[model samples]
Target: MAKARLMVVEDEAITAEDIRSSLEGMGYDVVAVAATGEEALRIAEKLKPDLVLMDIVLKGGHSGIATAGELRRRFSVPAVYLTAYADPATLAQAKLAEPLGFLTKPFNEADLRASVEMALYKAGAEAERQELIRKLQEALDKVKVLSGLIPICASCKQVRNDKGFWQSVENYITEHSEADFTHGICPACAKKLYPEYFDQLYGKGSGGTPE
Candidate 1:
């Protein structure tokens, strides 16, 4: 498997450096680092990193959560919040962004490794699920247009579908396709079958009435 590409976004220089070092040591790419939300967005658009470790507080007007939300909506990248505080209000705000993971500050190298690994795994699983659903939908579409061997009788217009069964045209169509049938009389059949009733239904010599 390829190593996960990571972007570190922290306002504190020393903490960012330490995290970068730890991530590199754990075999992650550590593709880019940003001190502000704007820088993070620029690097993310360029690098398209697989995951982002973003500090909740940043140097610019846009917070890390805001940047992460934009990345997710536009690029569909997964992010984990790196913060020193985990108060309920802050955590609730972070949760609204749908972060992959949360890591409190003063964490060790092992903690960072575990958190990153779990976030990448979760992202991978979600992507796999989406791909599976797409493939299933495609298969269903193919099945819709599949032309099977349908048996038909020479005398009557009825057809024999799969399973060696005989049924009316409407019944066979409704069973094989996602179609709903409504009963109605065509102009030719209505005029031939019910001329007197048709005149009674509508005015005299009117075309016909629907069944």
Candidate 2:
């Protein structure tokens, strides 16, 4: 199995190196390390890594939270924040980005492992869900984007097959699409064909003639 590709977005050089080393040791790939929020976003767009390890604060005009949000919005990548501050205010700010996981500073190897594992698992699940939705939408679009005007027999209300044969509308539609039909009678048709039944239920002259 391929190792999960991870990008470390930390401004502190030493900390970034440590993070990269730890991740590599854990059998996860450290694809690229970015020291600024701008650089992080650029590399993320280019590499499309599976997950990002982000620091809440970065050395740039933008914060890691903002970078992570844009990454998710544009590329659908999930981020795990590793920060020293756990203050309610800071966490609340990070919450807006909807990070997949968070690990506090001074974390042990186990904490790192747990955070990375959980984030990767959730990312995998989300990716699977997105793929399924895309496939379903593609199938629905194919059905909806039916070919150009269909030739039909106006009198019989039947359709002309591509093979130059006449076929019922239901059969033609069924053959050309993922659709099924259920028969039902409209009020007009019911009144016209079943006049006795219609009169028994609703007195004569209660409804207009069928078309």
Candidate 3:
């Protein structure tokens, strides 16, 4: 199987390299690393990583939470927050970004592995679900099922559409549904309309095949 691609968004160079080393050891591809929220967003736009390991506090105008939100909105990328500060206020703001997982600062290899795996799994499942919904909607859109009461003329055998305009049965059905028409003369109609060739064509029976 292909390794999952990841991006590290940490302002500290040493911490970012540590995270990258851990991820690479865990069989994940660290595609890029960014030192600021703005840089993270810029790299994410191009790399479109499967998951982002983001530092919640960074030295930039845009916070990690704000950058995470933008990554999700623009590229459908999910995030696993890395933070030393897990205070209630910071967590409250982080929740708005809907991060898939969280790893406290000074985390071990096992903690990193767990958080990254869970985030990748959830992101994949959600993407599959969205694609399934899109396919089902497309199928429903393509199907045209006719229903409800129809107003049709008894003598002419034509139908009245929603606009109150009368049309032939074949034309109405063809327009309102996936059905198409192929013209053929039935035995009774053929005998009645062309008596001269009835016996030769139908073998003198009510519903006979052409000889």
Candidate 4:
């Protein structure tokens, strides 16, 4: 498996470096470190890290909660909030951002590792669930298309779709499904359409092998 990429958003330079060093020591790739919410958003847009370690309080126009919410809404990136204030009011505001985990100040390396691992696992599972749902929806759509009673012209071999427009069989199927077509002429069609080239094309009495 690939290493999980991480971003750290902290206003304190020493604390941010400590977090970066700890995360890197734990085998995660610390892609970028931001000192403010604005920098976090800019870096998140460009790096698209797997997860972010966001400080709940920042010296900027956007708070960590607001930044995390923006990240989730725009880039689908999850955050693990780090803060010294774990009061009821702070927790209430933090919940609005829907973080993956919360770590109080002075957390140990073991706690950090556990939170990061669990968050990454949940994110991966959610991504897989979404992919499965998309595939199932596509399969259901294909079944609906093929199960319907299609109107086809017997002479022209054209199909009439739900929009009441006549289209070639290839065109209709291609539009409705993931199937594609490559042109080919069967022996019967070849004989009727191009008699002069039929014998040459089929290798005449040479058993379908050119002389």
* Best of the candidates, lDDT: 4
lDDT winner between 1 and 4, please give it.
4
Instruction: List lDDT for all candidates, in order.
Output: 0.88, 0.90, 0.91, 0.92
Candidate 3 on 26-96: residue-level lDDT in tens? 99999999999899988988888999999998888988999999999999999999999999999999999
Ranking of all predicted structures according to lDDT, beginning with the best and ending with the worst: 4, 3, 2, 1
Decide which is better by lDDT, 3 or 4.
4
Q: What CA RMSD would you report for each candidate?
A: 13.9, 12.0, 2.4, 6.6
TM-score of model 4 (CA atoms): 0.69
Q: Which candidate's TM-score is highest?
A: 3
Candidate 3 lands at a TM-score of: 0.91
Model 1 scores a C-alpha lDDT of: 0.88
What is the Cα-based lDDT of residue 105 in candidate 2? 96
- The global Cα lDDT (0 to 1) of model 2 is 0.90
On residues 101-139, what C-alpha lDDT tens digit does candidate 4 reach at each position? 999999999999999999999899988999999999988
**Candidate 3 stretches greater than 4 Å from native:** 205-211
Work out the TM-score per prediction: 0.70, 0.69, 0.91, 0.69
Whole-model alpha-carbon lDDT for candidate 4:
0.92
Which order, best to worst by TM-score?
Answer: 3, 1, 4, 2
- Between candidates 1 and 2, the one scoring higher on lDDT is 2
